[model samples]
Target chain A: MKLSTITKTILTTASLLCVNQFSAAALIPTHDSLVTVPVVSHQVERTSVHFSQPIAASQQLSSAIDSYTGISDEYWIEVSGKQLNQGIDLDVNHPQALIRLSAKQTKGAWLPDDHAIDPQDLSLFKNQRSIANAFSQKVTREQLATASIFPNSSAVKIAKKAGVGKFKLKVSKTLKSNQRYLINVKEKGSAYQQVLFSERQSYLAGQTITVRAAINYRERPLKNTKHMAFIKSPTGISQAIDYQTEQGKIRLAIPNDLPATKPGQLYELHISSQGRDGSSSIKRNGKVAFAVAQPTARMTGNVTANNQSAQIGLEVASEGRYEVSGIVFGYNKNKVLMPIMLSASAHYLQAGIQQVTLNFDPEILKSSSLIGPYQLRSLKLTDQSRMAVLHRNHVKQSNAITQLNK
Target chain B: MKKIVLSIMLCSVLLATPAMATQGLAFIHGTGNQTDAYSDYWTGSFVNSVRQGLNDPNKYTVINCDFDQFMWDSQAAGCLANQLTSFITNQNITELVLLTHSNGGNIVRWVLSNPTYDSRYPNIISKVSKVIAIAPSSLGTPLADAVNQGSVFETSLGWLLGYGSDAVSQQQVSWMNYYNQNWLHGTSGRPSLPVIFKTIVGSDVESAFWDGDSYCAGYQYQVALETTQNWLDSCSDGFLNCSSQTGAGTQWFIDKQRTRDSEPLSHQQSRRDCFNLDLIIKNDI
Candidate 1:
């Protein structure tokens, strides 16, 4: 990262590019690249010391990543910081198991100041001046406060929980297929009424069906929150729903069983609630459409290198959805490698498409090939297009032998 | 003398049967599922774990509200309320513990905030006690941004709600926006929620993270930060970035009993039906 060397190299490259393709390297250096690098370096140094004095603030863990483990269940969290200002995420290129810290210094010797703040180190965010006083440095304390949070956030509180809080049920699932639909409501032990809580249920529209509604609360001031329940059908005597204050949700399955949306029907499903005289509904689109459960295709296999070639295949069995992918698990020359590149969406695999020619640096596969045939991962329907993984250990397998098929 | 007497009485109640001594719970499921989604959530793993948490065989029940855009409107809410009312009446239920995951949290809030339907199910709220919300999207999810921008999911939700015509349907966006802004802020019109714990999930490892439809670990905190930036002033579960969900005593309780987030109902899980059994179980840890 030497500025003078970089400048000279860039100038040489640009000059060379000018002769090779004028359209490609169309710009001329405004100043000596060598001199400009140092000047820019000096500017960076000047801007860095904005907050030389460490401020006091507890680093709170984000809600999305496990604070204790830091490593995500599927992906590890790699934090990087320059000087004192850590990037918001920088999740993409960072390696797993790495914790990054950042901050800028107004001097070239800023490297020594760059390090993770030790939890035991108190007053890390202390002694910081008001942003108004630090205006020149642009290290406004207010901005820092805005950028960082204390340890008292909700995300941290949950991290402190000795037990993960869970929702309780009063009864069991009784929605029988091809039979009567039975829904029940109830509350667990009677101990925390002062702490208000309730339950609800709902149904989709445009379809005819019976539904029962209810609102269960913990008495007193919590009366505003509305808890409910309901069901949908094509058409018939709609089931009556109940909502009672100072009570718990109670339910019973309807005597008639209903069918799902058929081909001829242009209907979708929905369920929601109105809290304290207010209700919101979820539709079969956007942010939640994936929950609708679209027809999907699955393929499973592992990476193997018998000869000098590795072949992959995918199997399909979907109905109206698009896209599918398969990851061939294997080893190359020994370094861990995962080339995520497989996409099959929009059409079902009635005709199993199997066969993939993996063009890769044979070196990386030597170590991975021993891993065995990988049971392909499933792509969360959030994007029926992106081959990106949605969840792990989710790919459905085909009993019939399949090569990498789309 | 009066002060002494009151102190003694309070102490007796505390020593005899404090709320902490008696574990109360309620379970509600998110969207999706056909035959028995709520109860059978995660193929019954979730419900089973919740049932064990209540530590009562009969204490658990299922309210198959069938929300999750999985049920017919009007009817889903009404039936859910009925089931809740009957159960409270039948079980001498009082001082209950309440908990919900994802959309279930929204359903529970609606019931607590509305009373017009209360006549049918009397004193249903009176029996409740503690409240815990897990990854509840009290506010519209950041993923909704895409939906609002006219992604297939947003269009579907809009169409399903019957947007312009139905007040309830049209309320989706309004409610989410209002809820996100006020639940954390608690404006004059919208009072703050009265739950003991606003639990959230924190696990970056998810099925569809970038896709917005993934099980967002930050689902709760993101809404809090976007709306009342100062709401959760502390840390978050795992998925919600810590900065967004941090604030106040949204106290966290570490759960170590379960092997993994994907485990079957090792923690009290509930099954949906006429009775949601998850409402009865208690957590081992």
Candidate 2:
């Protein structure tokens, strides 16, 4: 759906209100009197993207080992796959592995005791070279039964220098005659780069999202890297997303014509990066999920406050249940604005302008010794039916309420 | 005159103390749309054993909702809210403890984190005293990724291993990271939740034919879990990595640390009455 001119006009009016009232003073008058306090409403611009697909049920796998056949001798299991600059760094990604070989009984039962493969019979190799000291000394029969394979410090050091490459686990010993075993490999640790999105969790369909990537556990930029990115829908459909990079930041716009997502499902942006730091190769994968919302309502920038409550105006586009939530900031005994209480209320409204009330507790005000010239901060309106965040205002100041009786 | 005086004294003693808080329990299943979770997901024995801690054992409900949808979906959290609210209101429960397994933790966490999401959510949050999550997939699992990967080799071989559902996709390693950072709470540097959320981590999977312990929750299930463990971290419960279980909430204890005789709890066993897990939870509540 395209952005309408009427929506633009509403957004412009809201923007003007923000510019005029955001800097208003939160000072309370020494004497109580009727006054006009500007309520700053930071209204979000709404788009016309609505998703209307029925939610799909989660799939369940019948079995996880339907493809593997019982093996009685040596076997090779690929630890990492060779893809386009996507080879994993063994040291950074998966440094240690627990390999267990369970004996398969004729009656389809798995026996941990009968298979007689020792820890010395297992070896890890990159391009078929034996890595010494790969297993720690704790791999007794008891440890093997539990599949606990701890990596030695020397082995970890050796893995750090192995760079980014495909790894394979090799079982050297043969099983007893007429016996078959099943192998299970488990690995851990990822020292890859960290990727994060800039604050907001939901965005308009046409809005841009910002992402930043840095080295593992450090804020340093991952420099001189090549990135491939894609956006995956809830239905497992993937589309390549074009991104612009500047100073280690990536920006991608949510396409207006993107397919509708199922209810409560989010779109994921996946990024795969590959680079070289000196002679060592680095590969990392990161993703972030966000909801793209269609605007169904906007705030009217009008508020009325009394001794006990405040009513905020909203302009609705359709009939549904909408919710308004905000934090109330009142002046303390020191005359500084501090958060006093948070209040939220929702109501069903027709397609027109309506108001929702935030009733402040008198006990709360009395206990905090709060005085007026109160302000509402972090005001938000959500379309509960659509499950979308419709609008947000950072701050809104209210008129002084006199005689908040205990 | 003596009999009347003794009766009056007994009545006075009863009225002196306030009424005890009505404690309630709920069992939330994971990853599927359950209609009869009491029998299908968590058997009757497990639920009954855990609910023995309640002041009124009858004050518990085994929630049967569609958890296969995303955590925030109407069928998921919306249904949960409805049932829990009914349970609280009908039973006059003042304090409620939630027992969640796997993705059930995420659904409950969604309600706690976003109190304003639904009109029913705030009330539910206020009533929840604590959440005892067992083998929670708080962080997504690598096994999910491998299953959803649907590599050409597996697809061509006609053994896709797993059904690629929205719930499975959501639990992928990267997807859970995204949800934790942006939507959920109680992770490191994220906002703390309104209620106490503690996790029980499952550390290993054992399927020995000779060992009776391996057959407690179904021997075949343990075999499948052992095979899937290959896709997880060494510190995994066959289905989820140990880090994933301890990802969102406070770590209550690992499997061997608290289970009967220090036996490890597999992913499936965590929901069953195996290894005296139910007794442990009963005492805690």
Candidate 3:
């Protein structure tokens, strides 16, 4: 039965207090056995393994073990189908089978808080049925006598066995939680090949992108397989490129063109590989995003150096930090000494045709060099974040700063 | 007694012939190939100014090598190596003092340290007496890393140094690290010749200004020093860090000197004054 708000609060408080009384090992599932999952049809090549007990997030396992075949708390399973003996591509967004979690309240800290179980706040489906949470009603523990069933049904039975229970069905989401409960995950088969982009962020116009694809096979490797990659722009522009294999993995380099669309546009990238024996054909599609960014604001200013402070006067577009960089050149003992690199930052809070003055000691830029008539050459103003050179000019004789030591 | 005195005079004249005289100094420009063989690279009439300062005409020779090629390119070092060989052979130079600035120091060191170059043109390596490197990029510059992955302004600055993208690519941090670790001192831990090497380091970086120091003193001024200083993390002359330019930990040199930008000099300016006629006259000669 559904607990009232007061009961939930009392239970929550009691659990927090009595949590230390229970064994830390008891919080984790003890059953270390796997059960076989029944498959649908003979035409499909499917393999499914089930953990008799739920796995906890904190449990440590060997990294050498695979998530599916070994003992990882997390696993990745791709769902694909056969068309004329060729494999279809599937990603996280579209899963053929669903993974659903069901929880029951047993004696002594039987279940973790619902918040811990579904930390992502996913919408819970009532009793693993199509009905949402609002329409579901509480059931007595005597009603769930037959809770364990194979793949389907028993949703209502499991809920009836536990007086307080909650369940959620998710597609393309990994089923993991701190709660100790029985979870059923049904997936159509594994993907034969996976293609991924080396860089996830958006690319710039006229840039080269690197793509990598790895083949996943349960049996023998594909012989004489040909792989190809293509990019289809938003304007329906398509181009096919050849790929080279390195250590049996396909690698392709895509040289993007000046983007036909505006900045921050998206395109479609597709890759397909087929074996000569006609037994394996894999195709994967991904979204390609790129942008052409503009430079930051331009700065117009002159800097003067004195004994106490170097005054910089400039007109800035935005109210942010700006870096003023220049080289200090002076004469020492009738010899033209070397130049030192100087840089300082100033923040302009006001925007739109604003003028600001930044003060810094001239000696910081002069750094043990003699003080005299010095010229600041290659003066550049740049935005701090974007590092865009807003203004660049040679101060020559006009941008002269002298340290009289006064 | 008159015949014996005449014999001594004849012997003294023979000993003072031109073939016995030692050739003087050679100046090599650093990275970006800023100096051509026909003109001064660092300062205005630098070759002539040094000659005048030393009050010597025929003793010193400046190698106006190509400045546009990548410093690591074999041709860049080969062209310099060829000039040193020809200068030594033609001048009947018995001993030579070498002065190099920036990347030029790297190339000269490569030619001297490499056994292959020493074997090919033995005179250039064997005839050298001392070397004075000013703000050399012996260990490479972090600015090169910035330039290779540079923004629009950084790229422009890199190009301004007479280095294109390809040349900037050669200056990446990994490449420079590898070059210093492997390319320098050749295959051996030390150079083949027992040459005495001196380094002039420029530490005029306004790093304090970045930290908002109140008493900002002793900064050397250059046109691009400020903009470029942000690109450098360590003590710098607005171009290269002091440690990289000086080969600090490599024990590659015999002695080292430092100049501050506040002292009215920078990487380029130090090269100018360091290789000046006064310095050559005082030390090399």
Q: How does each model score on TM-score? A: 0.30, 0.67, 0.36
lDDT of 3 by residue, A70-103 (tens): 0001112222111101221222111222332234
All candidates: DockQ:
0.01, 0.16, 0.01
| Residues B1-285 of candidate 2: C-alpha lDDT, one tens digit per residue | 999999999999889968988999999998877899999889989999999988889999999998867787777888899899999999988899999999899999988766656667777887889999998888887655544331111111111212245666678766676566545667654445667899999999898999999998888667666755655668889889898899987999998998888899988899999999999999899
TM-score top scorer: 2
Q: Please report, as a value between 0 and 1, the fraction of native contacts recovered by candidate 3.
A: 0.00
Alpha carbon lDDT of residue A62, candidate 2? 16
Poorest lDDT segment (10 consecutive residues) of candidate 2 chain A: A65-74
Model 1: per-residue lDDT, tens digit, B61-80? 56665463312233344556
Please tell me which predicted candidate would have the highest lDDT against the true structure.
Answer: 2
Ranking by TM-score: 2, 3, 1
Candidate 1 scores a C-alpha RMSD against the true structure in Å of 32.8
lDDT of 1 by residue, A1-406 (tens): 0001111111122232234232211111111111100111110111100000110112121112100100011111112222112112111111111111112121222222212133122111112311111111111222212212211111111111112122111111221112111111111121112121111111111112222222223333333434333332222112333323234232333222334421111111122322331222111111111011112232233332232223333333322222222233322346332232222222222323444333222233333323323222222211122111111121221221122211
TM-score of 3: 0.36
